[model samples]
Target: MEGILNILKPPGMTSHDVVDFIRKIYNTRKVGHTGTLDPDAAGVLPVCVGGATKFVSYLVEQDKRYRFEITFGFSTDTLDKSGKIIKSGPVRFLKEKELRQVLREFEGKIKQIPPIYSAKKIKGKKLYEYAREGKIIDIPPIEVTIYNIDLVEYESPYQVLIDVKCSKGTYVRALVRDICEKLNMPGYMSMLIRTEVGAFRIEDAYTLEEIKEKKPSLQPIDKFIKLPSVHLNKIEAEKILKGQFISNRHSIETSFLKLYDNNGKFLGIGVSERNKIRPKRLL
Candidate 1:
């Protein structure tokens, strides 16, 4: 009832819809998704249930990998096929050599403008909410790092597929917009598939149908957390749960460490502050 579900979210269902589905299946309102995947994009989405919900913020900060397609011909209001055709013009392409260079230019740290129809928030409200109200707002460029970007395949005259590994905030639709602008052409994201998010991969994800038909076991929360561990006796474990900082008995240097009971049951995470360990999050 408590752990993460690597869901292979199919196109058309919003990320929140998946969370609602999990809530019903597990019969617990404690479920939540780690990150938001656009309703039109399909792939790996990590949904956390029960105590695992507390770690969603941290898990969502991890880097992600995606395979997306960019079609050059027209630009859409949403920057994807679902939006209205806002701009159209004769398409042009850089030679294969020039195209690769253009993609390389996007690698590393760069400022990106997110699409107006995205979930990015502004003034404490989701951007899409403003767009739906027909309100125009200046969307600022955000600094995001693209760890790796490569031209996967280029189809004749119009479509180009790409694989990108980027920081948490990188929007693939926005990336397509920038690339098209760099090439001085009109384009929109034709397709998108999230291949990986931190340690969660598409191959290990389950569909809604599979999950409902065959209930599966949940994983331990600490399985993906990388940290040194400290095992505490009953007395020490009780002290931690009481919100009292304990002496750094093990003298661990890391800023954080995994906590466990003497019986090897995972407790949660601990913050190492001033040589004292405090319960940061407990299951």
Candidate 2:
């Protein structure tokens, strides 16, 4: 049972909760999740089974997409609906033209300050720990990329829906807060749903119940990896097993190859640099 699972994590369950559920369902400790979906969020959470857990570091490089709602005229400690209200004010609904222009500011590379009540660690302690202790600290700004952002619709003067595509580590709650600040109104995330993560999408996701009933729903591990396969002959296979990188400079393809033995066994990953191929991982 080693492969990728498009698990539909329901709201109110932490990412760890889902992982634990899978570990029990599969009766294996090798289970792991590709990304962490917040407790209040629900959607596609890719789960790694069996040896796929070894590739988690590489999967984290993939981008994520989300659809979330923002509630204006108020702010919360946790920046979401579950948090305590810390501030409130009147919010004037901006025109569509105005909203569009405001959204434009978010596209491309931008600096973002993460919400205080977050998983970020500060001085070897989680930021949420400090937040829980009512400690305020200057959280540094981080550079992040927002590939795309579109206003889905305005649900009300106080609420609006937005779809976003961003690089890893982006916090949608913070994005909503920043947008509200730009509009001169306090804001907090009212609802969030991660529609996609990397190549996984919510539409293909299976609920926990579905997995328990359907035993063989898991896809092959290599299907989710999607790396460029490079078949190594007898001589080349030995070099890879010995932690050596061999160059295929003689060949037309110059990019990194998803290494595989002559027997078609996946041998982890490798990169081609100059005239040499360096192994990045070993199965």
Candidate 3:
């Protein structure tokens, strides 16, 4: 109950809904999800429980991989099929060469504007709230890195399937919108499935039914987080637990390190700065 659960969130249930379900299952209020996945989308959602909740931010910042379908001939207010159609046109087929070229343009760092009907916040309010109230707000474009995009399949003049590996905050729906604009056609995300998030993959995810029957095998925090680690002696471990800064002889290059004791017990996380390691979060 104090570790992470790789839950396969089915479509139609919001991320918060999954968190609430896990809270009820474990009967603990300390459960939380790493990030939000669209209700209309299904895939891997990592839920943290008890002490694991303290490391949720680390999981949120990890890279994600997704497989999605972009349907041509229409654009929606939400940039996905769940929203009302805002525009439509006759579907036009693009050659595989042309599609590949267009996808290449999206690779690397690019500026992207998130869809209006999204969870993004503006002026202390979620952007979707303003959209629902019939208000128009200038949404600024953010720089996001698309690590790689591969064309998985193209079905005639209607749908193009793609696999995308991108940095955090990269919205696949927005990428579809931009690709359609470049192709001079209307399009919207028809289907989306997040295959991976950070080190968590869909293959290891558990369905709700499976979770109800058997308790999820919780992963150790040190194993889930990708960070350098430092093993300390009993004296050093005691110092860390007391919130004292210890000498950093390990010379870890990262800003943070997974801390462990002499007997190999996980000791939460430690912050490394200059040549000192200080307690960041102690379990």
All candidates: TM-score:
0.95, 0.92, 0.96
Clash totals, every prediction? 0, 0, 0
Off by over 4 Å in 2: 242-256
Top model by lDDT, which number? 3
What is the TM-score ranking, best to worst? 3, 1, 2
lDDT of each: 0.90, 0.85, 0.92
Q: After superposition, how far is residue 16 of candidate 3 from its true place, in Å?
A: 0.8
Q: State residue 212's C-alpha deviation in candidate 1, in Å.
A: 1.4
Give the per-residue lDDT digits (tens) of candidate 3, residues 1-283.
5899999999999999999998888889999998899999999999998889998987899999999999998899999989999999988778999999999999999999988888899999999999999999999999999999999999988999999999999989999999999999999999999999998999999999899889777887667888888999999999999999999989787898999999999898999988899999877
Candidate 1, superposed: residue stretches over 4 Å from native: none
For residues 1-283, what per-residue lDDT tens digits would candidate 2 score against the true structure?
4677889999999989999988888888998888888888899898887877887776777899999998887899889998999999998868988887898899999999988888888799889999989888989998899999999999668888899999998988889889988889988998889988888888988998898888545676666665677888888889988998786744535465678888998777787777788887776
Clash tally for model 3 = 0
What value of lDDT does candidate 3 attain over all alpha carbons?
A: 0.92
